[model samples]
Target: MLIDAHCHLDFPDFDADREAVIERARAAGVAQFIVPGTTRRRWPAVLSLGARDDVSVCLGLHPYFMEEHAEGDIEALAQALEANPQSVAVGECGIDARFGDTLDAQWRLFDAQLRIAKARKLPVVVHCVRANDPVAKRLRQLDLPAGGLVHAFAGSPEQAGKFLDLGFVVGLGGAVTFDRAKRLQRAVQSLPDDGYVLETDSPDMPLAGHQGERNEPARVAEVCRVVAGLRGQGSEAVAANSTATARRLFRL
Candidate 1:
């Protein structure tokens, strides 16, 4: 079975047919999902999804939604994690350079979540974009014991090596399915069997043929196939190794 190491199943995009979406994923052999919280307001929804035996959750503030985050939300996050023992990790949080205006606040929020992950001994589910080096640098500073995933990784083989060296595994998803993603394909080719996991970043990041459509957990199987083809390995082998790595990281 394959695990979607990072997906936002709790988002409203799936509200119309969440159960059907999940059933389809199960039918497609995608057995588990990790849904990370994006904001204080969304934590309840995220935690609700955790009630499912096959779904695990993480709590954090996403950098993309910096304006939605209020002061003291970090403390609230800490308390929420304390109260929600089922939470599997600490984020869908990290830096996104596209939003240059909020870069400073993003760092503050990302750093706070990293520290919380350190203190709680939980793995994290990061959303890095165009800032792998900076993210890696920050990660080095913390050296979190329960190293987490760099979700939807679109970095170079060298950068992937950096995260692997730091005890983290990069997540491969829809991005790698594109023919133009040659660099990412190369990174996939170079990853150790245990160095990465698959994700869909559901409700976003549609795959090659499904552009403009909503991505869902069921598509992680395709991600598995593409990654396997890139590595010249069988899909089953990729599924097994990625699943094992994800289970190890989240302790699920």
Candidate 2:
């Protein structure tokens, strides 16, 4: 069975035919999906999807939507987790330096979530962009839980190593499909199979050949093919290894 370790199926992009999209993924051997919440407002949607047998959910605030987040959202997230023990992880949260000014707020939110995850003894699904150093630094400071996925990882092997040292899995996906993403491809290849997992980040970061198209969980198999090629392994091997890694990380 294959697992798309990180995705946002609760988003409107899948509203038209979400069930069909999931069926397509299952047909392609993508048997499971871990949907991470991007904001407090979306927590209900994410958890509702997770209520299904095939889906697992992670809850937290996303840095990109910093403006919409309230100061009490972190406390609310904690309460939500306490109310619903089914949540497998804490995130879709992290720092994004690309969007200036929100950097500080992002750090504050990220730290809060990290603390929550640590307290709950649950893994975190992190979203990072142009903030690997600081993210790494914070991970070092907090010493996160045993297992987590750094979703859509685009960092140097050295930085990847830092996360791995903290027992976090580096998530590889569509970004590696781009020929110009040499660094990301190298990171994908260099990742130890046990320390990495696959994701599609659906409805965003579509693979190379489908750049302008909407991505879905079904595309994860293609991502496996591309990543396997980069790692000099077969697609089946990539699927199996990533699935095992994800299962271990999320306790799915």
Candidate 3:
């Protein structure tokens, strides 16, 4: 069975038929799901999802929605994680250089979350985009004890190695299935057995042939197959290793 290590099932996109989506995923061999909070306001819903037997959660302020975050949200995150031991990690947090306007603010928020993850001894679920070098540098500086997962990673093999060195596993999803993604495919091939995990980033990163539609956790099985093909391994082995790596990283 596979574990979708990073997905946002709490988002409104799934509200209409959330149960059906999850059931489909389970039917497709996805045994578990990790939903990461993107903002303080959304933590309640994210935490609520975690109460399920198969769901785990993480809390943080996402870089994309800088305006949605407030001054004390970082403190609130720490408090919430303390209050809810069911939370497995501290993220959906990281730098996104796409929004150059808030680069510094993003770094500050990412830094605070990393500190919280360090002190709490929980892994992180990072959403890194176009800022891998700086993100790797910051992670090196803090040296989080529990490590983390770099969600939706599209970096080169060298960059993947850097994150692996820092006790983090790069998340591989729909992007690697495309023929044009030679770089990410190379990274996938070069990754050590435990150096990566499978994720859907549900309702966001739609797979290659399923473009223009909402992505869901069930497609992780296809992702597993694609990854297995890339690595010249069996689909079952890819699923098992990625699932084990996720469980080890998030303690799920």
Candidate 4:
């Protein structure tokens, strides 16, 4: 069975057909999914979704919505974690220099969540962009207790190696299917299969042919096919290896 290591079924994007989406994923052999909380406001929704048999959840404030987050949100997250020991990880949190000026606040928020995950020994689901060096440096400093997945990885092979060395897995997704993503595709080809996982980051990052369309967890089989082709392996092999790696990393 395949596991979508990251997704956001709690988002409004899936409100119309969340049940059908999950069913399609199951029918396609996608047996598990990780739904990450984007902010404190979304934690309850995230938790409710995770309560299902096939889904897991992570709680944290995302950098993109940094302005909406309050200082006490981290404490509340800790309380939620204590209240629900079944939470699989502590993110959808990391740096996003793409927004330009919010760098400091982003770092602050990212570091706080990292500390919580370290303390609880839960893995993290990271979202990084144009700030790989800084993210890598911070991760080195914290030395997280349970290494996590770098969701939607679009970094250099060298950078990918750094995260792998730190015990983190690289998340491969729709981006690798694009013809213009030579660097990311090459990175996928070069990375070791055992330390990598697959995700669709659905309702986002749609594959090449599905550009401008909403993505879904059921489409992850296409991602597996792309990664397997890039790595000169079989899709079933990619699915098996990535599923096992994800389970081990998240203790799922």
Candidate closest to the true structure, highest lDDT:
1
Each model's RMSD to truth, in Å?
A: 0.6, 0.9, 0.6, 0.9
Q: Would you list the C-alpha lDDT of every candidate in the order shown?
A: 0.94, 0.89, 0.94, 0.91
Candidate 3 local lDDT, 109-130, one digit each (tens): 9999999999989998898999
- After superposing all C-alphas onto the true structure, candidate 4 shows an RMSD in angstroms of 0.9
Candidate 4 residue lDDT tens string, 1-252: 899989999999999999999999999999999889998999999999988988999888899998889969989989999998889999899999889789898888899899999999998989999887788888989999799989999988889999998989999999999999988888888898787999999889899999899999999998999999999999999999999998898888
Candidate 2 C-alpha lDDT tens digits along 107-208: 888888999999999998889899888888888888876558888999988899989988898998898989999988878878888989989999898999
lDDT of 1 by residue, 1-252 (tens): 989998999999999999999999999999999999999999999999999899999999999999899999999999999999889899989999999999999999999999999999998888899999999999999999999999999999999999999999999999999999999999999999999999999989999999999999999999999999999999999999999999999998
Task: List TM-score per model, in order.
Answer: 0.99, 0.98, 0.99, 0.98
Candidate 2, backbone clash total: 0
**How does candidate 1 fare on TM-score?**
0.99
Q: Look at candidate 4 and tell me the lDDT of residue 208.
A: 92
